[model samples]
Target: MGSRQLESFVTERCRSGTLTVTEACHLFDRLLTTRDPAPTIYPFNHLFTTLVRMNNLTNHYPTIFSLFNQLTQTNQISPNVYTYNILINCCMRVDRIGLAFVLLGRALKEGPGSNPGVFNPLLKGLCKDSRIHEAAAIVLDKMPKLGCTPDLFSYNTLMNGICKMGQIGKAEELVDYMVSKGLQPDVVTYTTLIDGLCKKGLLDKATQILQCMISKDLEPNVVTYNALMNVLCKKGEIEKAEELLDFMVSKRVQPDIVTYSILIDGLCKKGLLDKATQILQCMISKDLEPNVVTYNALMNVLCKKGEIEKAEELLDFMVSKGVQPDIVTYSILIDGLCKKGLLDNANQMVQCMISEGLEPDVVTYNALMDVLCKKGEIENAEKLLSFMVSKAVQPDIVSYTILIDGLCKKGLLDKANQMVQYMISKGLEPNVVTFNVLMDMLSKKGEIEKAEELLDFMVSKGVQPDLVTYNILIDGLCKKGLLDTAYQMVQCMISKGLEPDVVTFNALMDMLCKKGEIEKAEELLDFMVSKAVQPDIVSYTILIDGLCKKGLLHKAEQILQCMISKGLEPDVVTFNALMDMLCKKGEIEKAEELLDFMVSKGVQPDIVTYNVLIDGLRKKGLLHKAEQILQCMISKGLEPNVVTYNALGCTAQTKRN
Candidate 1:
């Protein structure tokens, strides 16, 4: 057959959806032998397009590349932009992104009436590799400059990439740009944004986006509802999720298996197991079978509540329903067993998993190792590591981290350092978390210089210091009374775009309080509030304790009232600190009233409270009253420690005086 006849055969077969891989290749091979009237690029485009869409057992990508190369070199036909797009797509799917971009560069140079479709694959490839900025640049600059105006596909692909990488602001900008270009936001666009916003915990904004989509007369698909529902469920807003489900049903959107699963999972998380079971039954009544994901969620909640036998029964139920347990299912069971300290049973579960031909993954191994480390069985943990290596399961960063943390807690710093080195040698670079652990331990041990060195080393290694890293250094400096240096570290973190969180402010406030710089600590508090960092209960307690120690009873009481105004109920420690100061001031009557107030407010006083009251009575020359208080404490079932008797010793001394 002639080249055009061969081309027509391939094109017809492709268009009719009857083209087999073998048949396409045979025709392409036949075309390469054409001597006259060579075929155009249309035939090659058709075949490559079909091959990529098929994506079967064979490596059709390499075949596409090979056929393109041979036909171009041997035939008199010229390759067009269509051929380049296909080749670029093929390169992308195989992760040869560099080659895809190279093809793009060649296409831009050839300049055959630039096609936006040409850059879609390139954008997709970049996004898949997490090269988001480059993808955005191509959409905003390269495509337009090359006369390939950004299309809906181009915008959607880049937006999805941005959202995945936690760049929600940029994704929103892309949506605005999409609308400005007159490409109305489609269902996919709305769904992607909602998913991103939901993931970022911007649930209210995500709901607004949904409302906007509805106003625009765009019907949300199951994917859109699922994304929003999943986040709401995750936030433990089961009631909100149910309301959303009702709204979804009102709009004629059917609740698929995923929707039911999400509802079940959400209810389970809120400890409403009966509600979850009802949802599961509702799902089954609709002829929808529950999968392992649905069962896993219920079992996980049961395990968390320490109802392992109930979880086991659920697992059996899952299996009877023909839903074979996967790795996640077994991992949950193993974690449940480990948490209950059933080490032997946990090991047996692992064996059972293996017996069912499911190999335990890194997560499963990490879970086992973490339990072992916490139990102080370092040798057993190390043995598990060796077994993992024997099974060809290379340990990830978490495995080494767990061992390091265990060693550090046991004061085996040298062993922990050795493990860090070994992990690095195994080609796994420690992330921010690993460094944070090491720095925290070193700082606590007064190894401030070494901790500072680690910060510098991590920076040099191209790992930017996060808030936790800076907070550690600041706290370390504060503990050493290096206030100026700690302030400098806080400022440095700010310059690095790390805002001072409540923890950072608290550390500074604590150091200031310790130095009797109450005024300065209060200023820091104001600064934290101005910066929108609300002080936690610890922050208030520190200031209150500092004022109480300074004998500023009125000022301390004001701080206590302020805390209460902010809805922070004073804990036992806060009350004890205040009562101790009152007793020392010889205001035993007022201290007694404060003790009654704490008890009436449901803040139970401990032995410390009684000791303070007894000591106050002794100082007030009321030995009989102090003895009656001690008897009351004993009657209340509090075991008096040396402090209680020491107060009586001081009472005898007072009598002698």
Candidate 2:
């Protein structure tokens, strides 16, 4: 047979999946030895592609590299762009990304002119490593300059990676760019964007995309519906999720395990344990048995809700249905038991899981260690850290953080600092939780400057501070009366897209009020509202208390009425502030009337309320009226403490004088 015929024979076999690694390699040798007219690069490309496909099973990746080297040495045939693409795929599969880029540079400079097909795999490698910005630059800018503009597949790949990072806005922008360059968004594009929107809790935009897909006659598939349903379930819109499922069924799109699992998890999160169980049964009736992931999702929510008994029963039921409980299942129950303060039960669970040959991972050890630490059993928690190491379970950030937190709780600053240094030395950078703990420690000790420096250190290490970190620092700044710095930090967070939450606003407002900047505090309340942040009870209470302290009785009562108008009933503290102001003005009757009003509103007055009343009546020399107030306080099953006794003692001393 001619070289072309032989090459065709090999390509046909390789493509048909009948070609073995040995046979493909032998055929290539025969093609190479037919020296009359050596086989074209087709056979070599096919053989390389075939070997790369089997790389996962036979570890033939290195063999492909050696064979390619052999082909180059033969000088009978040169590698084609297809050959380079296969090599790139192999490099990516083994995570040799640097080598893949080197091969790409060679393919661009030495091989036949590059095409979008050649750049796609390189894009995939860069994206898989989360080198998104680099990937975007190559596909959108670098490749097009080489006359290889990104195709639909190329755009879809970048979009998927961008979506995975929860960068939905950038993904959408890429879609517009793709369309501007004449590539239309497909179902995969829409589905990926939906998933990203769901992650960011942008349900309205996701649903709009869903409708847009249907409007374009692209046909919303099961994946699209699952994405939409998953978001709905997460938002506690279980009814809407069910309606979506019904809509999916009406469109002849069947719900898969993922669709049902999302629903089950959503129901579980909403504390509808029974509803979640029914969905599990429904999926079973449809012959789609619940997998380990489904059971874990259900049990995890149950465990989080402190329903350990229900979670255990679910595990038993899962096992009875021949579905094995995995490590996550046991970890969830163990965590729940530990949180419920059932350490012995947690230990027994560990032993039981070990007997079943399921080794405890770092997460399992963290759970046990956390409970022990919280119980102030730091020594026992420390031993657990060592025991996990003995079992070949390496400590993760959480394990060390749990230990450090225990030491911190016990005021072992030096030990906790050592643990942090040890983790850093081991190449595990501190995550937001670890940094938050450190920042809180410094902030509480009035080390605001050091805490801010630590924030800068965290950013230098590429760890972004979350809202909790900002809240801690802002609160610290407010405590140190660094109002200007605190305000600057709030603006900094807003610029970083970390919008000020109620905790952030509350901290700033309380500080402003303390500095007698009540007007500025009121302006902040208006600012938070303009930003769509609803003022919570704490926010209202702070304003009322602030006004009352400034002796603005009429203004304080007006604020109280405004709070009630907004459907926020004043708590005892709000009432106590108002009554204190009235008592200072010698309006004992008005203060007593305010107490009766608070009781009528079902806002139970604490001992502080009774003490305020007794102190007011005693200063007015109405000892008999103070005694009636004490009797009233005792009648409500309330105990009088030091403040109550002090007020009554002054009344007796005044009578003797």
| Whole-model lDDT values for every prediction | 0.88, 0.88
Q: Candidate 1, residues 1-657: lDDT per residue as tens digits?
A: 777778787788889887788888887777666667766778778888888888562466778777877865763766677778778888888888878877778777767438887888888888999999999988898778777888788899999999999999989998998888888889999899999999999999998999999899999998999999999999988888999899889989989999999999889889998899899999999899999999998999999998999999998898998999999999999988888878888889999999999999988888898889889999999999999999999999999998898888778889999999999999999888888889988988878999999999998988888999999999999999899999999889999999999899888998998999999999988989998989888889889988888888899899899999999999888988899999989899999999899989999889999999998888888999999989888998998999998999888887788
Model 2 misplacement above 4 A? 1-244, 267-292, 306-324, 340-345, 348-357, 409-411, 553-657
Question: In model 2, which range of ten residues has the least summed lDDT?
Answer: 53-62
Model 1 misplacement above 4 A:
1-21, 30-46, 53-60, 70-84, 105-113, 309-324, 355-357, 370-376, 389-657
Candidate 2 versus truth, CA RMSD in Å, comes to 9.2
Q: How displaced is residue 23 in candidate 2, in Å?
A: 29
In candidate 2, what are the lDDT values of residues 1-657, reduced to their tens digit? 887788888889889987887897798788888766778888788888788877363377777888888887886687777888788888888888888887778777865436677778878888898999998998788988887777888898999899988888899899889889988899988988888898899999988888887788898889989988988987899999999999999999999999999999999888888898899999989999999989998889888888899889988988998999889888999999999999999999999999999999988999999999999999999898888899899999998888888887787877889999999898888899998987887888898998999999999999999999999999999999999999899889989999999999999999988888899999999999999999988898888888988988889888888888999888898899889889888899999999999999899999999999999999888899999999999999999999999998898888899
